[model samples]
Target: MTATQAKPRQPDLKTSLPGPKTAEIMARDQATLSTSYMRPYPFVPDFGKGVWLTDVDGNTMLDFFAGIAVSTTGHAHPHVVQAVQRQIEKFTHVCLTDYPQEITTSLAERLVKHVERPGEKWRVFFSNSGAEAVEAAVKLARNHTGRQHIISTMGSFHGRTYGAITLTGSKTKYKRGFGPLLPAVSHVPYPNPFRPPLGSTPENCGQAVIDHIESLFVGILPADEVAAIIVEPMQGEGGYIVPPADFLPGLRALCDKHGIMLIFDEVQAGMGRTGKMFSFQHFDVQPDIITSAKGIASGMPLGALLAKESVMTWPVGSHGSTYGGNPVAAAASHATLDLLEGQVKHEGCGDSLMDNAAQVGDFILGELKGMQDEFPFIGDVRGRGLFIGIEFVKPDGSPDGALRDQASMMMFEKGLLNLDCGEAVIRISPPLILTREEAATGLDIMRGVFQELK
Candidate 1:
């Protein structure tokens, strides 16, 4: 088949979703695994290729969520697999302390180029996941600045670690029982146009955030004591909420004014998921540090903290990870970066894939706007590139988490995999490699679900 003709497709359901056998497997899993970490879906994915997954029952399903925004190069890309295969044949792991590997050095070099600052050099510290990246970034900032306080927004979702969770803002549910969190963290309001707090409009939300943070410095923590301000250029789990045009640049200015390091958590939105190398690129606001993990090394566990050289000065024995830059993982990352940089493609389709995201994302967003008009439950729809969200609200446009739950279940039953976020937002950040036609098909399926709910 030709390159275009070989594009992956949506799921073909010959039988009901989660058929009897899949349900049996999931039920067995539920009985054995802890409920806290296990969320049994209707499908048991056996394997995936490109944009489609074949479940154990031999059903092919479209992968819209892309393993929660990872797999940007799409599942099992030939080059990535080959790289991993080649590495395993040679050697799997060599302790970094004793033997530094070429693959790790190459991956770090590639990362430095991607996250370079205009006038300064860059460095990276590797980890196993996004949360670890955030923890490392916060620690780096603390060590570099000699400050104890960190600032985050109220609707953020950093990670689950004590330090990361302390920096997260979405409350109670994730933080309820986990007490004695890392201290000296305060939250400012995150900008949300659809349901602004204190009756503010979208246009003014950026200024409100600035004012709120400024008030904190005056009343709570002093600016010099604040080590870093961690934020998502586009909030991921907090509804894929894209701040106002001024939000990021404004925050950058505030960080500059206060001499606090700005950290961008690109864990979910980086690596072409936002149709760019990074979401921050679209906004022209450069963060002092960046935390990235998902989509960095395809599906393997890898996260990195990219920082300006000035803030990267940690004394020896400050912090380290045993498997942070494992050679096997680094080989995967090197191959993944090669694909992202257009070195490997079916037919030079990498950039075209980004263009596909913009075109298809525009159509999906338009369809969603139409749906919002028809269904009052849809309070708003906003995002850049392919990282989209649909916020649910009451008749008065306040958050309606219960209604969102109902609608999500309705969609799930109809063979779509969607994730709920914030209080009542539905996020649709699919893989970067999704074709225009596949995106339309997913949108159409979603529209049908919304119509059925209406």
Candidate 2:
């Protein structure tokens, strides 16, 4: 061990999972909240600072999932807290659609710089969540192209809203019994490298998906009538499935050839999660429209749709949101960008958060890769930056979701918080502010739990 490196702190557990206070809260929550809400573990968190959360019962634990990858700057990061506080004191809401506001405009301008192409002007539409952004993009695509057919890859999760759910192909449960999904929406093959579609090689998986779409165009879905092809640059809920390097570029070419708008749903992978401002940047592909939400406001609800000026053909009053661009959320987003861009450095952060994500993600990925030989259930490890996936498989090389579920609960009991994606992948998408020592600690805990399971 390096003598200069500080030892990571350990978790403080004074009680069991769902301690007395937490159990009480859960009971009340079940009675009061929607029955649809899902909680993988019973955690009644009352406080959070940086990469740790303290529950109502005073037990403290390390957070590795960051509230399903929503807390970008970390919990209650002072810069974000202060920015939100200042914004709250100034004003909370006035609605951006009807009112011209400075903070909202400023956030939009800053985000535009990150999304716009070299010679193309760009514009933004704000919403309260990622699903709204996807909905907005769909409307814009159809409105601009005057087409009915929209294509999305299977194993994709847009959101729960009508149009977004219709585009979501990850789980039928998301669309279950919701009769009459949006019409003319088609689902095609996703280029999942780990489990390639249509018996295509990992290298050709993406092309197989492209070919499947071409076949569709010649058959039922006409190429001329397609409005947009919405897909995640790297699939999130469908597994942190990073497609082959050729996928996004190929999709771009196809979209260009057919005059179809290409939409990159970056809700879970954007805002520095993948070591880039946008996940699509890694593939060197420019989407006609980009939908973002999860990490944009650092836990505050904020979503955005960025599109080429020419493509955002819908005129004003065509779509509007009463509380889309809340000033407080805009302020929080600016603070998040500041931390992410290295405009404001938190303690122990040597560089930008994006750099931190890359470095720590690389460190963890290397450790996990090394462990694969000794741990056969560690079937595959893949991701870009911190958006990682650890696939748990049986001896027969099939996904072992049961083992994953057990390991997730075990990790929770051991005071490490992570969540599963797809059927069996545990995603280690921690807040970008996580430090090296914390990363090492998380790895230690994970290794111990995995060893126990093995």
Candidate 3:
């Protein structure tokens, strides 16, 4: 029997999770997959549908992480499944080096139209993951400007690969044993009004970042030597830090003044996860190149480096990926995009869902803020759409990862799949398709944990 058929008709939390079956599987996994990649959850997922996952022990988990923001349209979404099934029967792989597939071409054309950069044409290069997209963005910046240096902000995460890891600044553990990294990548402080680097107000933090970049160019890396400035519209693995409202436009101005490329790593924030087609759209400031991956294909492996036509000047043979634009992935992407655009007229992300996110997100934030007032451990609550974070603090207002870790572990046993990020922030990025009622259920579960801890 198929997985869905063999499973119980509805979710059941029987016999405490990691029940004999799941424990056995996890034991085997420890010897197989790298320790670094294994998750902390004890229950192993058997399959998923909609916003829920059925674990090996038959426990149903409300997936708040959304595969870390990849399953925006939800798990096993029908449109995505049908698209992939159709594509798989025809052909799965095609060499872009040999002949481009129609699926990829369609995706690229739609992306260009979606970008709508002022007075700028757009192009896209397909990739297999967010890290590859970051690599492409950096390469495009270097080749376009004939410069060597790239600038990223502290408390930012581009990806895990060499170049992307070099750009990431959240933790040194990601780079400690990796040895030498990409050359000439510089870091500046990101605008965090809550804990300002130099005591700047939130209103002025945008200009502060701009000023810092300007000083860096004059006193550190020269303008002519800089290629691009990469930033997350809303920092993801970096504590869900949302910069000042004026930050993106200010960066755009500085980049334009210095002939430096502006690259937005939207891997974690794009694809309607933030209630907009793209997070950059929220700022009305366009980047020369934007990299996306996590939610693009709703869990299928896919990424794209979108650039204004002028910046996408690499020669025909400059770059290519064997499975980058695989027909199956492209079909999944098309289906995912259609669902996002509401063309499929699906149950997810209709006007009802988007409105619900704003409504419940506000409630959750308010509740978290109340908790902050009661418990000194709750430091902050901030996010856009459903991509929210609750950062923790000590009584002295310093980061206290230990307490946060304890709270997270407590939630895990309670059957929630939340993840921690940045210094001591808890991520609550559930699938975009998650309902208002479902969010309330999960938030109440979380609130119960906070109450217990208090």
Could you tell me every candidate's TM-score relative to the true structure?
0.93, 0.98, 0.94
Model 1, 372-423: lDDT tens digits are 7788888898987788998889888788899888887777666667778888
Candidate 1: residue 382 Cα off by (Å)? 1.0
lDDT (Cα, tens digit) per residue for candidate 2, span 1-454: 5999866788889998889999999999999999899978999999999999999999999999998889999999999999999999998999888998999999999999998777989899999999999999999999999998899988899999999999999988888899699999999888988888899998899999998898988888779999999999989999999999888998899999999999999999999999999998898789889999999999999999999998988987999999898899999999999988988887786679988898888888999999999889999999988999999999999999999999899999999989999998999999999888898899989899989988
lDDT of each: 0.82, 0.92, 0.83
Residue 69 CA displacement from its true place in model 2, Å: 0.9
Evaluate model 2: give its TM-score. 0.98
Task: Highest lDDT: give the candidate number.
Answer: 2
Residue 75 shift from truth in candidate 1, angstroms = 1.7
Q: Candidate 2 clashing pairs? A: none
Clashing pairs for model 3 are none
Model 2: weakest 10-residue lDDT segment is: 342-351
Q: What would the per-residue lDDT of candidate 3 be over residues 276-320, giving only the tens digit for each residue?
A: 777778786888999999988988999999998888998888888
Residue 152 miss distance in model 2 (angstroms): 0.7
> Which 10-residue span in candidate 1 carries the lowest summed lDDT?
345-354
Top candidate by TM-score: 2
Error of 1 at 449 (Å): 1.1
lDDT, model 2, position 402: 97
